[model samples]
Target: MNTNTGDDKSFLNRLSSIVEANLSDEHFGVTELADKLRMNRSSVHRKLKSITNKSVSEFIREIRLQKAKGLLEEGSDNVSEVAYNVGFGSPSYFSKCFHDYFGYPPGEAKNHTKTESDPIELTEEGKTTKTFKQPSRMILVVIAITVLLGAYLVYQKLSGNPSEKSVIVLPFKNLSSEESTQYFADGITEDILTQLAKISDLQVVSRTSSEQFRETALSSPEIAGKMNVNFILEGSIRRQNDNVRISVQFIDARHDRHLWSENYDRQLADIFAIQSDIAKNVAKQLQTILSPEEIKQIEKLHPKNAEAYDKYLMGQYLCLKRDSISIRKGIEYFNQALEIDSTYTLAYSGLADGYYALSFTGYIDRKIGYARAYEMAEKALDMDSTLAEAYAVLGIVSKFGYWKWEEARKYFEKAIEVDPNCMVAHLYYCSFLDIVGEPDKAFEQVNRAIELEPYYHMTFRMKGIILCDEKRYEESNEALKRSYELNKESYYNYSRIFLNYLALNDEAAALEKLRELFALRPEYLEYKNDITPLYESSGINSVLKMFLDARLELGNEDDHFLIPILATKLGMQNEALTYLEKACAEKTRDIPRMIRKPELEVLYSNPRFVALVDTMNLSPYFQKLSE
Candidate 1:
C-alpha cells in the first residue's frame, strides 16, 4: 500500500509538471497530454481519473482556471488579456469557467484572496489502492481492455476514414539570409492559401488570421485550438539568386503528430508547380478528392516571366496596405509588371483593385477612377474568364460605376460560384444585399465573411452597418466599437458611429463622434460646421435641409441621389419627387440603397414616390413594414 501511494504521487507530480510547462496551451487536453507523456490516450484518461477523480478534460480545465486565477490576482493584465494569455480564446468562456471552478467570476479575483484549497491531495488515503482491492489483477485487466480499445481505434483511423478536415497554413518563416526576401516568403504563403481556398471541399483559414502566428511560441495543438482547425501546415522558405528551397511539414493538430514532410529545391520559374504539388499532397493526406475543375484552377499559371510575377507579388503586398501612398506604389508596380508581360491577367486585376480602392476612399475622382477600374477589370476577364477576383472587380464597377444593380448581383453571385472562399466576393455581396433592402441577408453574408476572416476590421464595420439598417442600435454600436478597437484611425468607422448615435437620439454622443471624425479628417470641416449649427438651432430636419442644399451646390451627379431622402425628411413632397425623378433618370445606385432608410418612410406613401420606385425597378425591394 505504501508503494502504491508513492507511485500515485510520482505519477501526479509528473503530470503536474507537464501541465505547468504547457499552462498557456489551450489544446493541451487528452490527446496532446497523452502524446507528451508517451502513453495511450485511454491510459492517460484512466490514470488521471484514478488520481483526481476527474475526467482528463476536467483536469485540463482546472489547471487553466487556476493559472488564470493566479494571473488575475497578480493584476498584470485585464480580464480579456489574462484570458487569452491563459489559453482561452474568448474572455466570456473563461469567465464562465472561472466562475464555475471558484464560485466567483474572474473580475472579482483581483480583489479577492486565494483561500480555495487545491483539489488534488497527496495523502495516503487518496491512493487508488485504498479504493480497490487486488490492485495488480485490476491493473492487468484495465491494461488489457485499453490495449484492445486502442488497437481498434487505431485500425479504424488508419483505414482512411476521418472526420471533417480544416487546415491553417501558418505564415512561412523566411530562412533566407537577406531580409529583403521576406516578401517572397509571404507571397508563397499567400499563394498556397489561395490555391487551397479554391477547393470547395476544404476549409482554409484566411491569411489575415494565420499571419498572426508567424512568431508565436505556442505549439501546433494550441494554435489549432485557437483557429479551430484539424491540421496545420507550416514551412520555411530560402531563396538564393535563381534557386529556391522550401521545407514544409503537415501535422495532425489533434494528435500533435506530424503526418508528412518534404523538401523542395527548384528554379524560381517552377514555383507555381511546387505550390500545386504541395496542395495536392495535402489534399491527398486529408482524403479530399479534388474535382477536375479544382485541379485546373490549382495548376493554372498566369505570368510566364518570373520577374513579372515577382513584381506582381510585390504590387499585391503593397495594395493590401490600403493606404493612399501604398496604393499609388502598388499601381506603379502593377504597371511595371504589365510592361514586362502585357498578358499578365493578375496585373490587370491588381490595377483594377487599386483604382477601385482609391475611388472608394474618396482619394481620387470617382468618375475617372471607376472608369479605369471598369476598363482594367474587363481586360482581366477577357484574358481569363474563370478568375473570381476579376468577377468581383466587375461587380464593384457595375454597382458603383454603372449603377447596374441586376448585373452587379449576377457578377457577385458568379464570383462566389467560382470560388466560395473569396472574401472579397462575400463582402461585396453583403454590401449589395444591404443596398437592395435585404438587411437579414446582408447580416448573414457579413457574418460568414467574419467567420472566414475574423480579424478583419472591414467585415465588422459592415456588420455594424447592417445592424444599423435593421434598427438594432445597441448591437450596431457594439459591432462598430469592435471595428474602432481594431482600427482607431478609421474615419469611415467614426462616421458610422456618429450616424448610429444620431439615430439613437443621443445628440451629445453624436456630436462627440462628429468631432472625432473631423479630427481624423479635417477635409470634412466645412460640412461639419454647416451641419452642426443647423442641428443645434433647429433640430435634425434643418440639418437635413442644409445638407441637401450643400449637395445641390456641389454639382456632383453622385451627390444628387441623397437630395430626395433629405427633402422627404423635411416634408417637401414636391421637391422630393422632383429629385427622385431626376435620380431615376440618372440611374443612381444610392436610390436602391435608400429604400430601407428610416427618413424615407414618408415617401413610401406618396404616389410619385411609388412611380419613381417602379421606374427604377426597385418595387421588388420596397419595404412593406407594418405600422
Candidate 2:
C-alpha cells in the first residue's frame, strides 16, 4: 500500500501556501487554517499530523520562520522590520526562535545564505535535516555541539531569574455540551490565576488580559510573544452530571515546548482541589520557592458547599460583564451563594463588586449602593484579611463616596501588600496618588497596573485622565485613543479625549469627539444644539456660558460643585466664589476632585477659595505631600 501519495504532498503544500500567504498575521493559527480549509479543527489536525507529523500550529510557525529567513537574507529590512513583516509581534521572540531553528541569529542571516537547490529540510519535530548537498560528518558534529552549548546558555540565563517567571493563564475551553457551563470553565481559569497571583515570585497576567484569547486562533508561543511572558497555561474542562474532567498543558512558550500536562477526572466536589493542585504544580514546575504564606494562600478552599461555590463563580463571571442587567443578576447570584454559605468571603467580595458596579451604572441609588459595597467588603475582610478585592472595594468607596482620603490610601496599600498582582488595587492607588498630587508616583502605579492587565481599558482611561489633569494634552489623547480602541462604547474615554482636544485648542477635533460623546451619552444632547452654534458665532467663552447656564438649569444637588468650575471657567469670579462656598458648606461629593481641577486654579488666589480649601483640612496633607 503506497499510501504516501501525490495528493498527500499537494494537501501539505496547500497548507504551506496558505500559511505563507498570511505569514504576517499573528492570529493565523490552527483554527483559522481549519476554517480556511473548510474542515473541523480536529480533522485538520489529524490530516496534517498524519502527513507531516507536525501540528497545524507547528506547521504555520515553520512556514513563517522559513519566510522570515528568506526576508532576512534579502538584506532589505532590518531584524525588527523583518520580524514584523513575518508576523512576529516581538522581535526578541522572533530572534530567539530563529536562532533555535536555524542554528544562528537573524543578524547573521546574510552570512548563511542558501540557494534554491540547497534547500533545508525540517524534520517532524522541527529539527534541521541535511540540505540537498550533505556536509561532512565533522561539520555535523561541530553543529551538534554548537546547539548543545546554545541550549545550555539559554537555560542558565533563564534559570537565575525567578522574578522573571511570568505566565498567562488562558481561558479554558468549555468542553461540556451545555454552553451555559462556559462560566464554570472561566471561573476555574480565574481561580488558578488568583492563586498564582498570590505568589510574590511570579508575575501572573490578569484574567482580563487573557480573556481575549478565549476562542482565538493564536498559538501559545504567539500569545506569549505578544504579552512578553515566558510561559502559558491553557486547558479545557468538561462537566458531566456529578463528574468533571480537566486537561491542562503548560508550555515553555519561548521554545514552543510542552513542559507538562495533566488530565484530572474527579467528582464535581473536588473542583477546588483540582484548582489548588494546578497552581501548586505550576509553581513547582517554575522552580519557584513558595513561602509558607503563599502555600497557605494557594491551598485555601472555596465555599465548602459545591452548589454555593457554583453560584459564587457564576456571580463573579456576571459581574465582569459590567452591564446593568449583568450586575443585577450577579448580585442575585451572590445573594443565592450567601443563602447557602453564610460565611463565604469570596461571595461577599463578589457582592461588593456588584453593588459598586450598580452604583456606577446608576442602577441603584449611589449612597445605597456604596453603603452596601462597604458593608459587604467589611464582611469579606472580617472573614479573610488577605482578600485583596475586598480592600479594593473599601478603598474605592472610602475615597469616592465618603471622601476619607487617608482611610482610602490605607486600604489601597493594604490590598497591594496582600496581593501584589492586584491590578484593581494598583489602579485605585494610581487614582489616589494623582488626587493627592503625586503625579510621578501615580504614573508608576498605572504602569504597574498596565503590566498586570494590559488589555484592561480602564488602565488606559485612567492614564489618559491623569495626563489630562497634568495638562499633557497630546499624551492624554494618545492614551484615550488606546482606551477607545479597546472599548469603543466607553463614554468616559470619549469625554476625556474631548477634554484633551479642547485643551490643545483643536476646535474641530474637539467638536468631532464631543459629537461622538453626545452620541454615546444622548442625555448630553439636550443642550448640544444650544451650545454648538454659540461656539462658532460668539467664541468658546459664549459656549462656556451657555453650557454653565444649562448645567445650572438642572438644579441638582450633585451639580453644585460642577457649577463652580463652570462659573470659574466663564471668569465670573464672584459667582464662582459663591457656588464654591455653597459647595464647601454642603460638603459635596465632588469637592475632592473639584478643588484639583485646573479651572479652579484661577480661584486659588481668591481668599474665599483659600479659606474653603483650608477648612477642608487638606492643607496638612498637601504640605506633607510637598515634603
Candidate 3:
C-alpha cells in the first residue's frame, strides 16, 4: 500500500506523468521536467527529495525502468528495443541500471517476481523496508546478510569503480570585491579547460556548456548526471591587486567523493603555473597517462608578462559578448596585448577571431576584415605552429573569404588534428560540409560540436538551419525553439524560426517571429510599414520581396548574394540566375552558401545554375567528402 500523504502522492503522480510523457527523449532531464512542472528547478528538486529521498534523475530513471520492466514482462520487444523505448540510449547501460535497481537483470525479469516494499526507495534501506511477515529466525538472518552483501556490491559497482574519464568544470566563483574580476575568474576557468582538453584521453566539457551552472542550485551529482559525466571540477577565485587566491576541488560526482583539492595563493604572474598544476592534478587523479604532446601543450605559457595576459583575458571576455561594439573593443585589447609582447600567439589569434567575427557579422568590409584576419592568423601560426585556433581562422578565410573550398577543408582538418577538441574547427567544418551538399556529414560534424558544448545556442541554431535546408520544417523549428529558449535575446534564432515557418507555409507564425525579431533588432523595423500590409494581402512571398528590396537599398556590396535567394523563392528563375551570375562574377562572399538552399533546388537542372556550380568546382569535393 502507498504510505505518502495526499499532496505528496499527487506531486509524485504529476512528476511521473511529466517524465513518462518525455520518456523517449534522452535530452529530457531535471531542468526540462522542472519547466513542465511550472516551478524552479530548485523547488522541484527540494520538494521531490523530501518525498522520495531520491534525486530528480533517479526518480526519472525509476519511471523509465518501471516502464521497461512492464514492457519486458509483456514480452513485446527485445532488450535493445525495450531499452530505446524507455529513454535509455545504450542497451548495456540500461541492463546495468536495471540490475542495480531491481536486484535482477532485465533478461531474468521475464520470470522474476517482485517482493519489494510499496514505497520504493533507491537507497539501501529500501532493500529491507518490508520483509516476509512471519519468517523463521534462521531464514531472516540469511536474507538480511544476503541483502546487505548485495547492497554493498551494488554500491561498490556504482560508486567505487569509475568508467571512461569525462568531466565538466563548472564556472569558478569570483570572490573578489570588484565585480569586474569576474572576467578574470572566467578566463582562469577557460584556460584550465583548454589545458585539460589538450589531453586526448580526457573528455572535457567546453566552457559554454558548463557555464550554465554559474548560479544553479543543483548538487554536483545532479549536474554530473545531466552532463552525462562521472566527475566534476569546481573552484572559487579571489583576486586583489597583484595577489590571487584560487581554491579548486575535484569530485567523483557519482559517489560524492572528494578525490582531491588544493588552494593556491600566488602572485598574478604564476597563474600559468596554477592552471597547469590544476590540469595535471586532475589528470593524475583520473589515473590518465598524458602523452608528451599533451604535457607540452599544457605547460606552454604565453606573454610571460602578467599585464599583457590580463588584457588578453579581457579581450576574450569581451569578444564572447558577440556584439559589433564589444568585438571591436576586444580587438583593441588584443592589440594592446600584442603591443606589450609582440610574440604573444594567443593575442594575435584573438585579433584574428575578432576580425573574423566582424566579417562574419557584416560589421566590417569583407575584404578588409578577411585580410586583417588572415594576416593575424598567419602571424600567430608562425609563432606557434601548433595553434589550433590559427588553423581554424585560416580555414574560415579560405572558405568564405577566398572560396578556396579544398584549401578550407585541409585547414579545418588540420585544426582538428592539432587539437581534437577544437570546437571552432568542428563548427566551421559543419558549415563547409553543408555548403558542399553533404548534409549527412554536416549533421555529424554539427552533432560533434553539440557533444562538446551541448548548451551552446549556436550549435542548435546551426542544426535548425541545416534541417530547414533539408525541408524538415517541424524538426527545424524544434531545434530553433531550443536555441531561442537558450538565448532569448539572440535575433539570429528569431530569424531562423521565422524562416522555418516560411518554409512550412505558416505565414502567421512567420509574421509573429518576424515581429519578435524586429523588436530585438530595431534597424529592421524600418521596413515594417512596407511589409505588414503586403504580408497580410499576399503572404510570405510579399514579405520576402520587401526584405529583398531593403537589402538592395542598403547598397552593401557584400550582401548581393542574398538577391538570388530571395528571387528564387519568388519563382523568378531568370532574375535569380541573372543576379547569381553577377554575384559569382563579383565574387560575393556568401554566394557559395546561398546557392545550396532548397529554395534554389528548382535551378538544379537549369543550365546556368549548373554552369555556376561547376565554375565553383563543388561537386567533385562533395563526392570526395561524401565518400
Candidate 4:
C-alpha cells in the first residue's frame, strides 16, 4: 500500500507478495495468480489496480524490471541468463525492452560494452529546463500510475513472461464522411503515440511501425499477431466545426476481448483536456503505473485552434516528403499556423524542418537559411523543450547550422533518450554519421530503424544513400530500387544510385537507368544536379573536358568554362584561353562544386585557368585547399 494512500494497503501488499514468490515461474499471469490468491479474479485485479495504479500484469513486469536492474547493477549474469531468470525466454526481446526502458543499448547499460566515447556536450548547462517547467497535476498523478505499470511491463519483457506485458497503439480511424480530414485522425493517433513515448516504461512502437495497420482489415487478434502487442487501442476522431468527438476502445488482444470503451465530445478549447482524458483512461484500462511528472506532461495544455492545427497537420504531411516543393509548401502552412496562434510550438518545429530541408537539398543560401533554422529550432525548444520533434530539429541545426558533428549527435542522443522509438531522430542521425563516412555505425543504426519500422520507404533510402557513398553501388542501387518499387511516387528514389552507376563507369548502364528515371520525372536536374554529388572526369583536366564534352547531351553542355578550365590543366594553353572566355558567361550549379572535383587538380599551375577561377569567384576552393 502507498503510505500516503493507506486506503489500498491490503491491495499493494497482496500484489507485492504474489510478485516476490512466483516471478521466476514462466506461465504466471492474471488468471493463474488470481486463482492462487483465493479471491475472485476480477476482485484481485481490482484490488491490485487500486493500490499500485497498474494491472496485475504490469505489476508483474515492474517486478521483472526491478530484478533486471539488480542484475544489471551486479554485472554478473549474461544478458540472456538474466533475461531468462527474470521470466523472459528470448535474449533479443530482453535487449529491445532494455533499450526502450533506459534509452541506451543493453551493452552500454551493462557497463562493459563500450560503444563510442561520450558525445561532446552542447553546453555546460545542466538538465533541460523544460523538464522542470511544465506540470500537469492530474496528468502527473496518472503518470506515476502508468510508469510504475509500464516499468513492470519492461521488467517482464526482460525477465518475466512476454505474454503479459506488451502493448501497441493502433491507427485510429476518422469515421467521418470527408476523406480529407483523415489527417485529424492521424494526428490524434500520433499524439497518443507521442504521449505514450513519454512514459519510458513501455516499449511504445514508432508511428511508422504502427501505421502499417492503417490498411488492415484484421480483427484485434490478427492485428496483435502482426504487431506482437498484448494490448491494443483503437479509436476514431470526428471534428465538426468547434465540436470535436473522439471514440476509443481498448482490447486485451490475448483473448480478443474488449476491456474498455469510451466516447468523448468537447469544444475546441477542451481538446487538451480530451487528450489527457484519453491517455489517463488508456493507462487505467491497461492497469499500468504512471508517475506524477509524466501525468503532468500528458495533461499540459497549449493554446488550441482547430483550424490552425488542421493546417499544421497538413504541414506534417508535406514535410514528410523531404523534397524541395513539399518542404516549401510545408513551411507555407506552418507560417499560416503561427499566424493563427503565436505560441504554437509544433508550428515552429514545422518551420524549422522547412529551413533544414531547404539547406539539405543545397537550394537555399546556406549562410542565412541555416541561421534561420537554428533560430526557429531554438524558439521551438524554448516554447516546449521536452518535445522530441524540437530536439530532432536541434540535431539538424547542430549539423548544418553549427557544423558541429559531435554536438549534433549529442542532441540526437538526447532526443532519443527522451523517446527511444523516435523514428526521425534515429533516421536523420544515422544519415548524418553516414555522410561523415561512418557507414558501418550508420548501417547499424539504420538497420535498427528498419527493425523498428520496416514499412517506411525513407529509411530504405536513407540507408541506401550510405551504401552508395561507401561505393557499395550494387547494394545501394538495389535498396533504392526496392524503395522505388514500394512507392513509385517517391521522387528522389534513384538520385544516389544514378551517381553511383556513373562512378562505376558503366555508361550504357547509366544511360539505360536514365531512360527509366526520365520516364518518371520531366525534370532531370532535380535528381542529377541537386541530390547526388556527380564527380568531374577521369583524374585529369584535358581528359575531363573531353569527358564533359562527350556527355554534353546529358544536359550540362551549357557549362562552357568547365571545358576550358580542364583544357588548361592538360597544358592546352590556346584551348584553355578560348574555353575560359566561354565559361565566364556560363551559369552552372557545378561551378560552386568544382573546387572539390578531382579532375580540376591539373589546372592549378595554369595562370590563365587561375585567372579564370579568380574572375569566376572560384577563390573559395583555392582558399579551402590552402587552409
Clashes of each: 0, 0, 0, 26
How would you encode candidate 1's per-residue C-alpha lDDT over 1-627 as one tens digit per residue? 344477888888888788878877655555567789999866777776666666666666677788888888888899999888876766776776676466456887864565332121112221111110100100001111111222222232443424445778888898877655665667767777776666655567899889779899999989989988878878887767767677777788978998766567777556556545544444443333456676566546435666777777777876876665456556766777788889998899998898888766555656667778878888998988888888998898787666677899999999988777788899999988887777777887899889878978889988887887788877988998898787765555775676677678887787777666644432233456555677778887776565565445333343344566567757887987787676556545455555566657677878887887666556666654422
Top-lDDT structure, candidate number: 3
lDDT of 4 by residue, 1-627 (tens): 235365566557766687668777655655567777777656776666555556565677667766776787688887788888886655675665555344343555544222211221111221111111111111112222233334344443545454455677777887766555665566666666666666645556678778778878888888777877787877876666656567777677878988666566667665555546645645653444557776667545333665567667767765665555446555666767777888888888877777776654544655556666777788888987777767887887676555466777888888878766777888878876664545677898788777677778888877776676565878888888877776665645653454556667775565456546544442222233322223233332333443343323232233333454445445666765655445343422223333333335566666766776666444553555545
State, as a TM-score between 0 and 1, how close model 3 is to the true structure: 0.64
lDDT of 2 by residue, 421-509 (tens): 78899998998888888899899999999877789888998898688778898998898899888877565676556656766879778
- Determine which window of 10 residues in candidate 3 has minimal summed lDDT: 135-144
| Per-prediction TM-score | 0.59, 0.64, 0.64, 0.55
Q: Which is superior by lDDT, 1 or 2?
A: 2
What is the total number of backbone clashes in candidate 3?
A: 0
Question: Per-candidate RMSD vs. true structure?
Answer: 25.2, 22.2, 23.1, 27.8
- Between prediction 1 and prediction 4, the one with superior TM-score is 1
Query: Which residue ranges in model 4 land beyond 4 Å of their true spot?
Result: 1-168, 218-231, 239-244, 252-257, 266-288, 300-318, 321-343, 362-366, 491-515, 522-627
Error of 1 at 107 (Å): 40
For candidate 2, list the clashing residue pairs, or say none.
none
- Model 1 pairs whose backbones collide: none
Per-residue lDDT, model 3, residue 88, is 81
Candidate 4 TM-score over all chains jointly: 0.55
